[model samples]
Target chain A: MEELTSIHNQHVKDWKKLSTKKFRKQTGYYLLDGWHLVNEAVHAGVAIHQLIGTADQLDEHRELFDDAKAVYAVTPEIMKHITDTVTPQGIAAVVDLPDAHRVPTQPLTGAWLFLDRVQDPGNVGTMVRTADAAGFTGVVVGHRSADLFGPKVVRSMQGSQFHLQLFEGDLTKWIADFKENGAPVYGTQLNPQAKNFRDVHPGKTFALIMGNEGQGMSQELLTATSDNLYIPMRGEAESLNVAISAGILMFQLNQ
Target chain B: MEELTSIHNQHVKDWKKLSTKKFRKQTGYYLLDGWHLVNEAVHAGVAIHQLIGTADQLDEHRELFDDAKAVYAVTPEIMKHITDTVTPQGIAAVVDLPDAHRVPTQPLTGAWLFLDRVQDPGNVGTMVRTADAAGFTGVVVGHRSADLFGPKVVRSMQGSQFHLQLFEGDLTKWIADFKENGAPVYGTQLNPQAKNFRDVHPGKTFALIMGNEGQGMSQELLTATSDNLYIPMRGEAESLNVAISAGILMFQLNQ
Candidate 1:
C-alpha cells in the first residue's frame, strides 16, 4: 500500500537491478511488465513478491489485489525505471524464477528443441514458443545462447515458459544423456548428408538441434548427433531465419 | 569527410528525423545501423548517403571506404543520436530506398506473402526475412501493418529488405489484383472450413495472407480469398507467432 515516487528509492533501485543478470541471479526473481504477462504469471501460480502499478493501472486491475501478497501505487516515472520496455505499460510485477533445473524424469517423449549459440533473444524466444505449440517436451538453451530468462526472451515466449521445461548448461552432456535414454539427436545442417525434415516422423522421443544465427552448429555438436536434417529451401536464400527454420522443422517433425 | 558534433547541425538534424516515417518518406531514404546491416546494404548496392562512425570503427573497416560516398567521423555520443539501437555498433548509414513498386510489375509467379494489420515491427521484419528465404515474389504490407523500414523491423529482417520487394497499400485491392491475374489468394485461418497448409498445393503462383498478431484476419479479407488454409498444431498453444506461422505457411506453399 506504500507509494514509491522518487527515483532514488531503495525499492526502485532493487527493481531496476532485475535488468542485469547478476542481480537476477542473486535475488532469484525477475520483473515482468505489462498486464498480459503479469496476468499469465498469476494464472500459472507464479509466486509474486510484489505488484507495482500506476494509479490508473491499479484502478483497472483492482481485482488482482485479492490474491497479491503486496500492492504498491507508484508513479509512471518510477514504473518506467523498473521496467525494461522502452515505454512502460504502467504495471509491473516481481515474480520468482521457476525451478528450471527440474527436467521431467521421463525422457523427452515427443519432439524436443536443442539450441546452440542462438544469440538473438527474440529468435530464442520465438523458438521456445513454437516448440511449445508443436508439442515439444522442452527447450535446452546451449552454452553460448542468450539467457532464456532475459526480458525479450520472456516477452517473445508469450507465457510458454510455464508450459515447457527450460534448462541451461553443457548441451553435449545433455545430448549424451538423451542418447543414453534412446532419444535420437537430430542436428540440422546444410550438407547433402542431411535428410529433409518432412521425411522425419514424430515418435515417442527425439531432439532437434538448431544452431547459431550465422555460424550454424559447432562441428563437435553436429558430429555427435545421430541424424543431420534440413528444411529444403527452394528459394535463393542462403538460409532460413533460425526461429522460422525451427518452427518449420518442428511442424514437419510433428506431422 | 566532415565531422558533425553539434546536435543541431543540419545533417544531424535530418538524420535524426529519419526516426519518423514522414521524414523517411520525404527524404526517400532510411537509416540502418550495426556492422552486419551496413555490410548487407553495401553488398546490395544500396546508395549510402552518409556513413557515420566513431574513429575506432572507421579504423577497423577502412577497406569499406573504397565504395562509400561520404564517411564522417564522430564521437560515440553522436553515433547514438543517429541510431535506434541501444549499443549503436559505432556505425550508422542513411541509404536510399529501393524502388519496390517497380520490381513487382509482373504478376506474382511464386509464393507471395500478404500481411494484414500485423503491427509488430519485429514480426513484420521476420515475415519479410522468411518470405525472402522462401523465394516469395514479394511481401505486401497492409495499410495497418508496421512500416518495413522501421529500425526494429530492419534489425529483425536481418537484411532481407534488400532481397525482396516490399509493397505497402490496401490489402483488398492487391488481393483482387493478384486473383484476377491467376494467382490464387490463400488466407491462413483456424476455421474447420480451412484446409491444412500441408495439404494445399498453391500451384506455382499464389499469395498467402497472414493476419494480425491478435486477430488473425479481417472477415472481409478472409471471405475474399480464393482458399483458406491452417497450419495444423498438435500442442496446447493457442496460436503460433505470426512470423513463425508465416514462415510455416510460406515454406509449405512453396513446397
Candidate 2:
C-alpha cells in the first residue's frame, strides 16, 4: 500500500486531472468518486487502475483493494482536492475507459437508442439509464453528444453503464447498419408529416434516435429514418424534454 | 427607471435574499433569474412585484415594465449579485408566490399528477413540465416534495409552469378528494400485487401519484389509492428515474 498526504503530491495532481475530458482521453482513465460506483465497477470486472481512499475507508472496504492494480491511502484533505467534492466520500477509483469505438462482433438485435448531438450530461445519462430499464440492447452516442465517461453523465447513469453496451460512432453509419440488418430506424420530429408514435409498433430489433435540446433531429437523419415519429402533445407545452420523450418512446415501443 | 450601481444597495440585498427558502417564505416572493421566465410570468398573468435588470437589458425590454409594479435598472455587478448566475442574464424579476394552499373553486375534470415527497428539485420540475406536455390538468406537490418556486425547479420547468396548475398539498387529502369526485387515484409502487400500469385504462378524470426517489410512496398513501400501479421494467436496471417513470405513466394513462 502507498500513502499520500499533500494535495500537491504528483499522484494527487494526476488524479485531479481526471475531471477534464482531455485528461481522461489522454490517459484512458476516469475517476469514480464514491463507494457505490467503485463497487459496481469491481462487480462489472472493469479494469480499475488505482484505488484511492482515506485510511479508514480503505480498511472498511479492504476487499475492493484486491481488484485494483494499485492502492493508495490518502488524507481527507487530499481526497477532497482530488475528487473535487465539497464533502468528499473518502473513496475513489481510477477506472479504465472502455473502448467506445470498438466494433460490434456480435449480431445487432433488440432495441437500440441513439443520441444525435444530445448535449446535456444529465439528459444523456438519464436516456442511457432509461434505455437500460426499457431492456434496450445498447446506446450509441452519436457525434457531438456529451461524453459518456464524463463525471456528470457517470453520476447520472447510476451504474447502468455496467448493465448495457455503450458505443461511440457516426450516427450515419449506425443508421445504415441498423437498416442493413433489417431493423427499422425511427427518428423523432414535430413535422406534420411525421407519424404519431402510438401508431408505430416497433419490434424487438429497431433503433430510436433522439436529438439535441433546442433542435429536433437533423434533417439528414430525419430523411434517412424509416419513418419520423412524433408524440402527440395535447397540451400547450411546445415540446417534451428530450429525456422524457426518449423514456416514453422506449417503454412504449419495447412493449 | 431608478438605477443602482452597487451590489450592496438595499434593493439588491433584498432581492438576493429571495434565493433562500426561508426568506422566500417570509416575504411570499421568489426570484425569476432570466428573460424567458420573466416573459412567461408576464404572459401567465402572474403578479410581478418588481423587475430588476442591467441598464441595457431594461432598455431593451421596456414593454415588460408595464406589467411590473416596480422596475429598477442596476449595473451588471448588481444584477449578478441578485441573480447569482456565474454569467448573469442581465435580467430578473421579483414575483409573488401563488397561494399554494388555496382550495380549488372549479370542478376537477382532467388528469392530475401528484408528487409524494419527490425531493430532487430538477426531477420535480421535469415531472411538472412532462405533465404539462402530456395534457395533465395540474400537479400537486405533496408534503416534503421540492418547492415549486425554487430556482433550480423554476429553471427546469422551462415556462411549463405557465401551462398548467401547480399546487402543494398533502397526498392523502388530494387522493381522498380525487376519490370523492368519482375519479380513480393511482399510486405507484413495486409490490407484486400492484397492477401493471399498462393494464390500467384511465379516463380523462383521474390522478396519478409518483413517490420519493429513494422510498416509494408512503405506505399510507399506497393503501389509500383506488389501486397502486407499477411500470414493468424489462431490463435489469432496478428502477427507472422517477421523472422518467412519471413521463411514461402520464403519456400511457392519458392515451
Candidate 3:
C-alpha cells in the first residue's frame, strides 16, 4: 500500500474536501473517521472506496482489510487533516452512500419517522437511532434537515444507520404515498384538539412527524396528517428536548 | 475587573486545574464554560464565583449579567486556556458546588428520577433537562454517576438545573425514604415479568429509577422497587440510548 505523509498530498486534500456538502453531493460518498465507526461501517456491509490509516492502526484492524477494494497507509498528521474529530483516531474510510430510492407505495408496515428541518446533527442522529429501535421502517429527512451521512450524525447514531433505510426527499410526497396505503399519519402539535399520544391506537401502520429544534412541523405538513397528537407535560417547562420528545412519542406510539 | 493575561496567573491556573476531579473537590467549585452554560448557572442560582471573559465577549452579555458577583476581564488567550471547547465563547464562570442539603428530601408533588451510575456526562445532563420538562420534583444521582455540576452535564442540561432540586446520595437510602413516604418506586429493567411502561398506572407520586448506560438497574435496586417497567421495543436493537430511554419512561410516568 502507498503511504500518504504530507498535508498537501492529493489523497489528503480530496478527503478534506469530503467534509463539504457539495463535495459529498458530487462524489456520492462520505468519510467515516475513528476506529469504531469505520469498523461498524465494514460490519454493515457498506462498500468502502478506500481505507487509510497509520501502520500501527492498520495492524490492529487487519481483519477489516480483507474485503476492502483499496487500502493505504497514512501518517497521524494526514489522518488529522482528513478527519473532523478534535483528536483523530489514526483511521478513516470512505464508504459509498446508500441509494435513497423511494420505496413502493404499497405494502408498507409498522411506523415511520418523518423529520422536518431538524438541523442539529445530534438530534437527527438520535431520532434515527430511536426510530430504528422502535421498529420504524425508514426515516425521511425533510427539507433543511442535517445531512444523514454527516460525521457528527454518524457518531451520534452509533451505527443505527446500517439498520435503517434513510430517505432524503419530499416528505409530502412520502406522506401521500403512505396515506394511500391506509397508514395513519400523526403530527406533533400543541393544540387543544390534539389527542394525547397514549390515547392513540398503535395497532395500525403509522408515521410520526417531528419538526425542527425551534419551529415545529410546517402548517402545510401538519394539515396533511390524519391526526394531531401532543405529549402531555405536567411541568412549567416549555417543552422537552426535540430528540427526547420524539423518543417518548415514538415509544408511546409503538406500545 | 482584573485582567488575567498570562497562563501563570494564579486564578487562571487554578481554574484550569478544574479539569481534574481533585482540584474541583479541593476548591469546592467547578468550571462552567460557554455563554449558554454560564447563563444557565446564573439562572439556576448556582453561585457564580467569577465570570471570566474578554471585553468583547462580556460586552455582548452585559445587560443579562448586571448582578454577577464578580466579573474578571481576560484576554482571548487566557480565556482559551481555561476552557475545554475548541472555540471558547470567550466566557466561562466558576460556580460554587451546591450543598447536598438543598436537594429536597421530600418532593412537593409529582414523580422523581433516580439515576444510578449513569457515567456519560451528556446522558446525565440530558436526563436532568428532561426531568425538568417532565415536571419531576427532583433528580437523585447515585453512586458512580457523573457529577451533577460537571461542565459537560451542565451544558447538556441547558438551564433545567435551576428549576429542579438535585440530590447526590446513596440510592438505597433514597429508595427507603420514598417507601416511607408511600411513593411507589418504578425501576426500568428487561425482565419478562416487568409490566410495559405504558400499561403501568402513573400515580401522582412515584420515583422512576434509571440505571447505567450499559447495565440497567442493579439487582438490589430492582428488588427494592414496588414495580418494574420495561419500554417495549420491536426491533433488533439491544436497547435505547440511556438518556432517551429515561426520557421516554419519565414522560410516560408523568403522563
Candidate 4:
C-alpha cells in the first residue's frame, strides 16, 4: 500500500531498532525473518502488527498478509538496510512477543524446562525446540539469558515457540514454585555426586533446568533442585553441547 | 622457530589451501583453528604436520611443539590472512585427517551411529560429540555430508573424534554389515508409520542412521534398516534439530 525507499526513513529506522534486544523488549515487538517462520507465527495466531517485503516476496507469500496488518513495500536498498542481512529472505514481520511470560502453569502437570543464562541464541532456540518435541509443558527463560524474542533465537526455534507455553522468571522462584507444586525439579551438573541421567525415572510432572554453556546451573538453583543429574561422557570432551544434552535429558525424563 | 611474514610465501600459500574441502582432501591435510582444538590434536597423538601461531601463543603452548615436525611464528597480518577470522585466536595447525576409514568393526559388538548427508557442519560435529558421550562404539560419516575435518566441524566436535572410532563409508554397505553382524539398525524418519523412539528398547549393540537436514535418510539405507524410528513430537514443530535428535536416540537406544 505504501513504499519506503530511503534508509533514513523514520519507519525504516524504527524497524532497524528491532535488531537490538533493548529495543525489542521495550517495544514489546520483534521481527521475524524468512517466510517459513513468519508463516508459522501467522498460523499460530501470533499478533503480527506489520508486514514488509519486496513485491516479489509478497507475490509468493501473498496469503500471509490476509488479515489486520499494515503492509509496506520497500526498495531493495531499504530492504537491505532494514534486515541487515546480505541475502535477505525479502520478507519480515513486526510481531508482538508471544504470551510466554507466565508463571509456571498453575497445575504443573506437564514437564517444564528452565534455562539459566544460556547465552547463545541458537542454543537457546534449540533447547526450546527440543523441549517442545519432548512434549515438555513449557520453557522458562531465566534472567540475563539471550532474549527469547531475538531474531536468531526465533529462527533456531523454527516456530516451536508458537506451539508451547514459554515463561521468563527468576529460576530461583520458578524452582521454589515447582517444588511446592509437587513437581520434582532437577538440575544438571557434571560431577560424581550427581546421579546419572539413566537412573532418573521422573514422574510425568517434573522440571529440568539446563544452564549456561560454560557455567552449569546457578549455584542457588542447583542447591534447590531435588536431584542433580549428570549425563555421563565416556569421551574426552569435557562436556556435551548444552542443547544436545537438554534434548537427551528431556526425552529420557519425560518417558 | 622460523618466521613467515608474507602471506604470499610459498609455504604460506600451501597452508592456506587447507582451508578448502577439495584442497584438503587432495592434500590429505586440514587446518585446525584456535588453541583448544590444536591442543587436543597435539595431545591425542593426531598427526599434526605443522603448527603456526604468534610468539605469545607459541610460548604459552610451547610444550605442544616438543615433538612437532615443524613450528613457525607468523605476523598478525599473515595470521589474519590464513584463518580469515576476525579474532584468529593467534593459533592454528596443519593436521592430517585421522584414520577414520576402517570397515565397521567386523564383529560389531557396540553401538554405531551413521550420518547420511547431514550438511550443517555444527550439526555434524555435535552429532559426533554426543555419540561419543552416549558411549557409542563408532561413527560412520556417510557421503555428501560435511567434511569432518573442516574448520567449523572440527571446532564443534571439540576433539571428540580422537575419543571414538570414526569411519567414512557408504552407509548402505555399513548398514548391511551392521545387520549381517546381528546388530539391529535403526533409521529416523518423521512419519506415523514409523515406531516411536520411546517404544524402542534396543540392545547394547545397534546401528542408528541420522539423515540429511531436509531429506530424511536415503531410500536405499531406509529399506535396509531393521526399523525406521521416529522421535514423536508433542508440539507443533515439524522436527527436531538433527544433532538434538541424534542425542536423544543415542542415549535412549544405549539404555
The per-candidate count of clashes, in order, stands at 0, 0, 0, 0
| lDDT of model 1, residue A39 | 86
Per-residue lDDT of candidate 1, residues B1-255 (tens digit): 777788778888888888888888888888888887898888988878888888999999997777678988888887888785687889888898654455467655766789999999888988888888788878888887898887888887888888777888788988888889987999989765688787777688888999998889999999999988987666656689888898888877787
Model 4 C-alpha lDDT per residue in residues B25-60, reported as the tens digit of each score: 788888888878787887887877888998888989
lDDT of 2 by residue, B36-110 (tens): 889888888998889998888888888998998999988888887777679988989898877878987567879
Off by over 4 Å in 3: A1-8, A34-44, A53-63, A76-81, A86-92, A101-109, A190-194, B1-97, B101-110, B179-184, B189-196, B215-229
Predicted candidate 3 versus true structure: per-residue lDDT over A1-255, tens digit per residue: 787788888878889998887888888888888877787787788888899898999998898788678898998878877886778888888988666655644577778899999999999988988988888877889889998888788877777788877888888988887789888889998664788887888565888999988888899999899888887766656677889989988887876
Structure candidate 1, residue pairs in collision: none
Candidate 1, residues A144-251: lDDT per residue as tens digits? 798888788888888888777788867898789889988788999976558877777747688889999889999999989988898776655667788889988888
Give the C-alpha miss distance for residue B253 in model 4, angstroms: 1.2
Best candidate according to DockQ: 2
Q: Which stretches of candidate 4 lie over 4 Å from their true place?
A: A99-107, B99-105
After superposition on all C-alphas, the RMSD of every candidate to the true structure, in Å, is 3.5, 1.8, 4.3, 2.1
- The candidate maximizing TM-score is 2
**Judged by lDDT against the true structure, how good is candidate 3?**
0.83
Candidate 1 is graded, for docking, as medium
The DockQ-derived docking category for candidate 4 is: medium
Candidate 2 docking band: high
Q: Where is the poorest 10-residue window by lDDT in model 1 chain A?
A: A99-108
- Could you arrange the candidates by lDDT from highest to lowest? 2, 4, 1, 3
- lDDT of each residue in A112-146, candidate 2, tens digit only: 99999999999999999899999998999998989
TM-score of chain A of each: 0.95, 0.96, 0.94, 0.94
